[model samples]
Target: MQWFLLGVALLISGYFIYGKIIERIFGTRPERQTPAFTNNDGVDYVPMSTRKVYLVQLLNIAGLGPIFGPILGALYGPTALLWIVFGSIFAGAVHDYFSGMLSVRAGGASVPTVVGRELGTAAKHFMNSFAVLLLLLVGVVFTLGPAKLLGNLSGTSVPVWVAVIFGYYLIATLVPIDKIIGRLYPLFGALLVFMSVGLLIGLAVSDKSFYAAGITLENLHPQDLPLWPLLFITIACGALSGFHATQSPLMARCMENESNGRFVFYGAMIGEGVIALIWATLGMSFYDSPEALNATLAQGGPAAVVNDVATSLLGGIGGILAILGVVVLPITSGDTSFRAARLILSDFLKFDQKPITKRLMIALPLFAVGFAISLMDFNVIWRYFGWANQMTAVIMLWAAAAWLKRHGKFHWVCTVPATFMTGVVNAYLFSAEIGFGLPLSVAGPIGLASSSVMLVWLLMRGRREQDDLDTPAIAAEQA
Candidate 1:
């Protein structure tokens, strides 16, 4: 019954957040042709039908972040899933949809471009540089973390070094933004569906105890930290992700119908939120002890737990299928990451315009960096990735708020979610001070610093615009 409720919530949230709100705002732009300013020959400039756009966006945006965010959220309990689902629909979807539409309408520019236009050239470059660094961190954490986990699940005995090398090569060969994603994305989607269905069936047949693994209301932790900050961490996907803002604009360029932004942006986000909910639920069901969870995560790794859960539910065949699904999960995510890295480099550095050899030269080094990170400690990397992801979302939320105010519809929209997230993120950073609570690691501080800078910039920009409006107009009578 809870699962059914979750499914319904997922659908409703997707419609409201993405379908209604996003479509209403940017949907009108589809009828218009690509703006003259954005004339580029790369995949970043290619136009496609709304359906295909949605599919690609869905796969690309729904990366490993969703998979792990919920697992961490589940540490708080099953109810954490509630926050993730709701936040994804109401907050995450809205930010993604509008950010994409805004970028498209503005000549297929990225978030950094939007920032530059609204703020200043200096701000644009600053944000772009920050985004590049953030993406590199994300590539390392998100791509490599999953690769290591998948390796554990497969038992292929491919050492971390080999797995990382193979993964990088596979991505370079199969997921190049220019030629591969269009051909391979659908195949990846098919693999995901097969694995998801197989795992679901296995769980259903062998595990009659649905809620046994869940943390009940009575088990809620009695920490002194405020609810809002914890919620910020638990429902981290939508409110403010650095990663989403980067990818959203990239997807915007390919949108067939500008009006479809809501569906593609919001719908895809809801899909990711649903993915997170499933994984978190599974984690809770399979591991009851925090120590045990950590130990298992340490020894067998998180991917191993995914296999254990599937095996517990489905026996030997199910375990094998589950392993296959786990393996594909990271690969799909890595493919998306690979594409995102390409887009970041191509757009910011104009690398896409370079000769193929030069482009390859740029891509190879990035692949190597990611591979090296994968061979190291993925858990530490994931923590920083989460922080960077949320920080990006924070900037987008502020931008969305500005957009709403500019359009004169601020009163009707649910800006509270955005506001709440901003405050919570700030508080999370503050908690680290005075040494009274949990300190988010170095990566957390980096994410917090970036978000703080962006927020201050946005606020000042808003005030300046308002001040200009307040000034009286010069009269022609003096002439």
Candidate 2:
């Protein structure tokens, strides 16, 4: 319980303290016109209040990752709390803030273009392909998962639910930003908040049975998965996700002021960390023991836990609301994942989005591909999505580090986390049976050594390219 409370407090306090530090480090320029105004095409770049942008950005990046991710991470123990709190403030929020602000300064450039500008075109091209694939994979998985749930609720067939959901994605992807996303997101955001807050209240007042499973130094994960890299990767979106970097550019094109980047980007990430912490605490403390929770998980899955909590703790009207929250969170994220993919591709092709025909030209083929993937076994897609999500973050973090270095700001703010995640991704890819068949002992050292080498290389490059602190670093690295 103490760990849970402290984690909650840390996430809230982080927004006020660390958020401002990041804002200053990025040197926000309110006097400068943001892309929302300068590039207000009304298709993807339309100015909006900081609050709306914050909410949409929140739903865009979060999906089921923060909610389910933390619950799954909790299976590892309270050490997951450490990753959620520290990683959110130090790594996640900071990454989002810088990446969003970088896009704003670049006239709403997509993340790949930002990477190209800061890191190099080769890095940019790699990210372009990697990000689009990740987005499509996430979009399809989120779509299929939610549609299946909605099917259960509505008594509709899975294929029918899928077609309906894909119809929405098609429209949402093709329409202007304000048409569907800007209007409905506030309601979805409110439902999300209400569900989380209700569970929090339940946790506070419920029997000690709920809080009995508080974590200790001992490993409690049923599978005995090593905590080092697995825990970090498990809790990506709420902590440090590259997926957030992709969504940042969406809000970057909609921000009203450069100074608003802190609130929209950094603040939204901290908000997600709080949601993740809530789910983690509930997942951990609700069970009588780690073994019990694992037993339940084995029988069902993460959604089973959501069903248990919604029906058991928050009964009555709150229960209905809780169930709906679980149902819609993925839908909200899926729509925007497709939307973000469209924007990324548009930027990549240098295609104007002013024509609805042009938007569909790209969106149709993309959706066709995603729809085909939806036909395969979803678990396979989800397993790869998790790894790809973190790998994307690693690339964006390196881009942020390069941006900071050229501008003479504190590059370590991003570089350190980037290096850390570099190790995390490599370790997972090398050690996990789902990935490579290497032993953890061997893969762990190799991952860290590789990351250390890259860190040193980045530091050396930064030293060579030092520039005046008074001006922003806008130079593109050589291809």
Candidate 3:
């Protein structure tokens, strides 16, 4: 209970303090024209209300990551609470703010274009493929999880739900942003907030005591997954995620004012942090101890926990809330992931999305690939997705750090966290992760060597244009 209170306080205070610091560092230009105004193509670059934009952006990034990831990450102990508060404030929100601001400055460019501008051509080419793969993986993961739950909820076959979800993903990925995503996101956002806030209230009224005893630094994970790196990767979106950076530019193209960047990007991440901490608290408190949560997870997977919590906490409305949390949220994220994939590919190919044919030209092939991956075992894909997700973030953070340095602002805000994430992602890859099955002693050295090489490359190559302040090239680089 004590830790839960502190987590909520920290997440809220971060918006006023750290969120402000990032805004000052990025230096948003209120007077300048945003891409939606300058490049209003209607199909992609449509101007939108700030509230609508915030809701869409929040739902886009909010997905199952914060909820599902936190429940699993709670197995690591109370430390997950610390990561939710500090990592979101320092690392995750910072990454999202800079990426969104960078896209706004670059006239609503995709993340690859933004990376190319800051990190160079090699990184751009690398990110072009890497970002697409990440989106497809997320799109598929979100699809499988939610479709299964919705099938259970609606008493339909899993394939029926898959077909329904795929149909929606096709439309959401291809249609104009204002139609489906723009209008429905506010409703979805309300439901999401209600679910989270309801749970918090339930925590207070319920008989279950969130045992602060077994969830401290001394009581490590039952699985013995070392906290050094596993905890960071386990709770990627709740704490930090590179996936948020990719999704931010979608909202950047619609933002009316640069000053709202913190509200949309940084603010959304903190919102997610709050949600993550709530679920983490529930996971810790609702169980006999953290170990019971782990045992339940191993026995029945994430859906088990979500079903148990939602039903137990909110007795009457639990069924509806369960469907919303386990089903609707992922479907929202899944569709948007496909949308981001389409936009990234369109940006790379120099294709115009103003034409419906052009939109289908990209959407058809992307979903085909997603369909192929969806056939794989869901959890297997998820494990790989987690590592790959953070790896992408490490690159984006470095790119954002370079963006700050070139603009004559403080780069350490991003660079320091980027370096820490650098170690985290690499360490996870080196350890007995995915299929490596290597010992920690051997993995540590391998992780360090890989991270050191990437850091050196970023410092040398990421700043060629950063220091070249004489050429005002921001306008010329729009995607």
Candidate 4:
């Protein structure tokens, strides 16, 4: 059942990502450009071919967000995989594809720029500031936590601080998107594929017996947590995430083929969702007791879980392979985050295009802040990221709906995605209140606040359209 579901996810992701969504949204010929910004340069503003842009966007958005997020979701068992697989295809992919195309139509503007035009400059600044804060939180907690887990698994003498510093340095050196996609991405992808295959092989060979000791679904409930909130957390990546909006715009700035936006943005999202499904299955297949899994994770961290699973299947080498996989996954995400931070800073600060060195200046501080945060409490930062991510998605979905209405195609293209996003977000908000028992956490409040703002904006905008229609009819009759 798990493998079948995973295959379904991969197929859907492949189709949408390959071209289906883009063809529907863009329809070949280019749209009109706003008179606000006209200058274009080859270096930062060069037009790219669809294939190159698709690959670059894939790498950019396919980072650690999907991997770590899914692993966390897997704690709930196999049902989580079901949500991720379906949600990625319907909700997450749609959000990313539309957000990227909308930005492209607006002359390669980032999310903040698009929001600023529609919701006022103050809203744009708020959104950017919120995005920066979310990124910083992600860098410190989720991004760096994966590295620390890797260090523990590898049994390397390297201290956590040293590992983190080296990680940041590696990211700083690869700030240029071209160098990252051209050189580092392939290497990272190869390592991930190798490790994943090895782990699977080891699992097949393990003598412990799959259903005997490793695969029992006993004692699945550890905290007596309700099913719904657990499901929300489990199915997190497929629903709304603020991080995706931020990521979509970064890819939008360099899109080669406006028509390939669906493949790059939606495809990458589905890829992440598929990865999550695999990890969730692993969680179910490997551990019998949720308490044991939690205890193992707490004692040895996530790497310990991977190592134990690998060792059970492939022996000692499994531990080594697990460490390698964990370490490389974070590097991929860190590189993506570093580039994202640089782009966000450049766009927000209006830095000079010359002397690309200036962009590094901005990135340096952001990296330092991320590094410092990583050294502190990581769990808090991660929870905050979850909330902030959902908030960003809510705002973007509302915007996409509005854009679709303006184009007279809201019924077919925009309505469904927007409705799914709004429903999931609202579900999560309620989950936070009744399920997680965190009535006042930032995640719940931000989601509520954003949803309220979006509802008002959609309603008022609709009313204004009606008023305009009535005015035109009145004028015609009088004439």
Task: Record all residue pairs in model 3 with backbone atoms less than 3 Å apart, i.e. clashing.
Answer: none
Q: After superposition, how far is residue 172 of candidate 2 from its true place, in Å?
A: 0.9
Residue 267's lDDT in candidate 2: 91
Residue 321, model 3: Cα distance from true site in angstroms:
2.7
Residue 204 shift from truth in candidate 2, angstroms: 2.3
TM-scores for all predictions: 0.80, 0.94, 0.95, 0.79
lDDT of 2 by residue, 1-479 (tens): 56777888888888999898888887876888877887788789899888899999988887888877888887877777778899999999998997788888777777888888777879889988999999998888888777766665567898998898889989988899888999999888888988888887887788744333444666678888888888888888789888888889888889998878888999999988988888888888888766777787786567778878777888867877886887677888888888889888887787778999889899999999999989988768877888999999888888889878887788888988999999999999998767986999999998999799889878887444643221144312211
lDDT of 3 by residue, 287-308 (tens): 9876788888887688778877
Evaluate all candidate structures by whole-model CA lDDT and list the values in order. 0.59, 0.83, 0.83, 0.58
Q: lDDT per residue, candidate 4, 125-156, as tens digits?
A: 88778777766665555455555656565555
Please state every model's RMSD to the true fold in angstroms.
6.7, 2.6, 2.3, 6.9
Candidate ranking under lDDT, highest first, comes to 3, 2, 1, 4
